[model samples]
Target: MTITSSPWVHPEPSQSQLHLDVVPENVLHALAAGESASFVPRFVSPYLAGPECLSLWRMRSGQIVDTPTDAPWITRLMVDPRVTAPVGVAGFHGAPDDTGMVEVGYRVDPLLRRRGYARRSLETLLAVAQGHPDVRTVRASISPENTASRALVSSYGFVETGEQWDEEDGLEIIFEVSAG
Candidate 1:
């Protein structure tokens, strides 16, 4: 896969040489076995087991792909090479309804926080969503206390709609980025 430079609405420079590739199943198995340790904390949960992570990467050609089980969206996002990396992952309740309105989710490594990776990744994800005729909107659920997360998504045009109790996390503030 080849990474091409594209117009980025965010402040960061568009990465011209970065390509987003689908993670191979073997790599995912290795990660489940705890062979690789990069970006481990950035995963959700099932990924910890190594089967469901379905992780991808932003790399130049000839780079080996590592699988991280915690990031399932990597599978869907890989539907388009234009999606460089997955900033987040969401499951059943957080997934899109029948209307194709999916949720935007992410988890940055604690040490990697505040480095603009999330923003850049999110910008790419939003761009991919906008390009898809099926996606009408992208939603995100964040804890009110997660100031950094709130700021990140809000800066990208996600607006607060309300709050609700999530089975995984208690009360979360709902935000959405509409295609309109």
Candidate 2:
């Protein structure tokens, strides 16, 4: 399902809302305010520090999830950088299966704990995901022990699918939200 034929595409946001073009400036201000870190491995994975990592971390492109199957309609969650402090990021993954399904995985900035940024970011990303014609479902994989993250997604209509996994990061909970 190419984006061109997808019913999800729509007009951009209002000037008041944060969008891609405003991210870099927002991030720079957030860094200066000490509200968030630029790109620390302790907060993110060391593997995310490469050139591609910077692009992903900055939300400059939709490259957060790179797979041959994810060539189209995959987008990064944009942050206000200045106001957001980027405590977390919403990473989107998708494929061209014509089912309009996408997945969002995220992480938060450790310093800006309990500020509801993750929830807000996820909400915004979900709205964007729903606007795409090829995105009928959005999914997420959360660490079971991460109570805050679990609560955030669950509150926004995501439901656990009884799926669990033991990755290098320990237990993970899979959640999904329908586009409708």
Angstrom error of the Cα, residue 157, model 2: value is: 1.0
Candidate 2 per-residue lDDT over residues 21-138, each given as its tens digit: 1223343333324344455432333223333345443333333223434433343333444553333445465452467667776554455556655655666667767666767888
Question: How accurate locally is residue 134 in candidate 1, as Cα lDDT from 0 to 100?
Answer: 61
Highest lDDT among the candidates is held by which one? 2
Off by over 4 Å in 2: 1-78, 81-87, 96-98
Per-residue CA lDDT of model 1 for 1-180, tens digit only, reads 112223223323455322223334454445545554554332322333243332322210112333232233343211123433333332212223579787765554343356555666677567656765666888878999999889988998899999999875699999998965
Report the backbone clash tally of model 1: 7
- In angstroms, the error of model 2 at 68 is 6.2
Deviation in Å, model 2, residue 120 alpha carbon: 1.7
Candidate 1 TM-score versus the reference: 0.58
Q: Best candidate, TM-score-wise?
A: 2
